[model samples]
Target: MYEVIATPFLEDFLVMRPGKSGGFKIPFHRYQELRDTAGDRPCPEWLAAATRKAWGVELSGRSADAVLVREPSSYGYARASYELNLGCNYDCPFCYLGKKEFEGLDWEGRETLLGVMRDAGVVWLQLTGGEPLIDPLFRETYGRAYELGMMLQISSNGSRLHDERNLNLLTQYRPYRITVSVYGATEETYDRTTRRRGTWRQFRRGLAAAREAGLPLRLNVVVVDDNAHELDQMKALADELEAEHFVYSNISPTIHGGPEALSSQSDEHLRARKPFTGCNAGITHFHADPFGLASICKVGRDEQIDLVAEGVEGLAQLPPIADKLMLRTGGCSGCALQDKCGTCRPLAKRYQEANAPLVSYCQHGRR
Candidate 1:
């Protein structure tokens, strides 16, 4: 009966509860008071009252008291990313999924899979892909996941999502959030980046539809060489639309471990990559592709474990490489590239090119 709680002011805090998406984020003093007052008992009276008062949820009948602790790991994964389908209408030159072939579980199969993940202690599930909404079973699959008490997030290109039918379907399930990747701010740039005519207009239409429906909408401005010049316009567009949130992403790599994507990466962006921002893949995050193959992260997508054959238990058997920051072999081993190394080790290893040098992203070359 133990529950996890979070405070609005603090970072993500977790209590040792299973399958619960952490508790409400209340005020600071109130959070401290609840922590101080809570005791090991059937349930704390003050904590329950505080929660009810703060979040307007009655927890009196609940069996166990809630507590704040470090976020859970290992057996309990808080979030899982699923590639719903590999079918995408627009073909971007820099696609990392590598000319994805259409694949997805049928409705019954997806339903069973969602149940398995929920039972395995996953509370937040992100539906992503070449384009999640393109799949025929996406709506039903999303609805089933939400009904299973899993907080749902979706990553989309906004093509089909702009359709009135698809918008209505998404509105029905009411996802926690949806991220629409904006390839470019203008039609020319957008078309160039996505290599598809009419996508920019469709993207705008989708954004408008999402906003009108009051669905939580965020923007992912995929900054690539093709659309690098319009980064400011993209941000301005997001601001004008009053999106819930927006972020820039230029770190995506080519599928074959090439530095072509890096060629267009800005100098500022390269310098920004100098920090050791760690990865949270196998540690607390996991990704499963459309074929029911699970990987530690997007970079490790090729190194997949068959989720259908092994189920969630396969996650336990996955290699614990999430913490690895430095390559033990290859040209990068003990090299002075340090923080400025833009070579993704997983991506390098994916194409049998581990420790290979990438001059386009190396600070050593500039030095």
Candidate 2:
């Protein structure tokens, strides 16, 4: 088993340890030198010393296999997010996924999908879902991705973090980070927001257990009308756990273009987003839904490439698709404030389709 991964990140080379965040960036020559060394040979002196200093792991006598060197790829994506399943235990009205249908590929299909991601040069992979931890094949999927030399991150609601089996598995094979969503600080408010009676207790227990286990955690403070009054309390709770956190106030329409979720947005807490800067969504990163449909990003699901059927070769179609999606052609066409608009095209289209008021996403609405 490899302890470190030497892979090509976008335009640079990196030497990173498995299950850890942050790594050392090396020049092409240095990467080449390490790659040329035989895998069965003893670990290189520089690498051994670096690992000892950085992670306190002594790689002195270990063979070069201690470091897995990934081959460079013509495919551009270096990061991707995969939805393992869409089933959840709780029902939050503000969920953008709309329908929480529990359906996805079988284990064999999942393995093949992961293989395609690896071949496409995905180095940083995020495992997410309605509740990824509850997926029946969570352990198998996570283990396979780790074995394929991809650093893993997870997004969850934190309801199952207290389970002994989950805690044990996560501790043994660490994730770079687990991002948990915080609906409210108090039990009543929390339960009301999720529309689940006992979720507040489970979430609290899970958070405490994860903190005690010394896991890297980040809290996404989901601000909505139901929990808006508890914003400060929520932040305090995150601080009490000593976890990193950020506030999320903007609410979007459901994936099917329904405006129902927009009603939950907290008016007072909502703030304008930064200018619509270009992103590498489809260019250097992509999102895979439960069925292995690859799209430019989560919001732009209009055009999807079936990775399960076409494999990595299908990724070639994404760049142009990304370009086309970014253009302001519909309600946004011929607008003078295009450069100042904060929302991206695909997202804007969703709001327009839902007949959302201008103030929700338009610069003119703010004026």
Candidate 3:
């Protein structure tokens, strides 16, 4: 909670290099419009410092208790998410991980990843995928991830969670937390948003099963044009479910296609690459394709910075050449939110490099 005054203000953020529609240059004039109608009394105290740091030294307005911490790194009572799987079942138009050349993944990638985790002393493994539950490799991957003595973070569409057998299996795997997509408060909305039928029921069943199983849970909602108006309803559903935590954010442009590519996209998109502003890839974490072709970010899926070879071991393994394979590079140097944006490198190809800086993304979103 913070303060709000009558003042006009504006600021630029970053998504992926390209905009949302797989194209990059996205001018979110909405911020300017919002500021003009906003007051300048004082932002909440919590948000003041974060705003200053992300936007650079000088910020005229006050603040609030917004995001300004390193919490997005490692979650839970304790542990960090070692990346796994990239394919997802949903294809909301606003999805960030563009339709990449995902095909016949060598399951060996998981074995290699497990080895890396063992060497790095990683304790928590985050499981994601085109649909991790559906993947035939999950049985092996789950066992391996568990064998590494790491807590697993399972993020899913929630459709599979409802199966009693699967739910029991999940219990055996002992995932630390299950983050599910909260696309809508009703089935009609969810089915349309996910571009599939009968998904809403399955997803809800999964979430309920997880909750009943007492798996610590969090809910993620992608706030977009089609659903922003229903923010309250979404929250209400979370409350009804008694979720431990619920988060809402815009679809990131950091993956394959940027937000602009989804111009015809609906608002109920889900998040692919976790949202962040100043994406210091390899500095702390690395992204990976199923085959274990590590990328800097998810958008400009490049191959230059493959950490899998030497593995995310000591600092020396990650050379000084921190190229923008996934995180963007162009417009970043001059952007006000440079340190706080999820500037994906892939976005460079999605949109004209000229307008990257003027873009906006959720800065280190989790915190």
Q: Using lDDT as the measure, which candidate wins? A: 2
Question: Could you tell me which residue pairs clash in candidate 2?
Answer: none
| Runs off by more than 4 Å, candidate 1 | 1-74, 244-251, 256-271, 319-327, 337-344, 347-359
> Model 2, 1-367: lDDT tens per residue?
7888888998999989876899988899878877888476788888888888889987754456588888888896899999999999999999999889999989988998999998999999999998999999998999899888899999999999999989998888889999999999999999999999999999999999999999999999999999999999999998988889999999999877889899999999879989998899999999999999999998999999999999999999999999999999999999999988899999999999899998899989989
Ranking, lDDT, top scorer first: 2, 1, 3
Winning candidate number (TM-score): 2
Q: Ranking by TM-score, best first?
A: 2, 1, 3
Q: State the lDDT of candidate 1 residue by residue for 69-162, as single tens digits.
A: 2222336666788888877988876676666678777776676677657655676789988888878888788877765556678899987777
- After superposition on all C-alphas, the RMSD of every candidate to the true structure, in Å, is 6.4, 1.2, 17.1
Model 3: residues with Cα > 4 Å off, grouped in runs:
1-86, 100-104, 257-280, 297-319, 323-329, 332-367
Of the two candidates 1 and 2, the one with more favorable lDDT, higher being better, is: 2
Candidate 2 Cα deviation (angstroms), residue 97: 0.4
Q: How do all models score by TM-score?
A: 0.75, 0.98, 0.63
lDDT of 1 at 122: 70
Estimate, for each residue in 209-263, the C-alpha lDDT of model 3 and write its tens digit: 8878877677886566655666778888778888754565534453533444345
| Pick by lDDT: 1 or 3, better one | 1
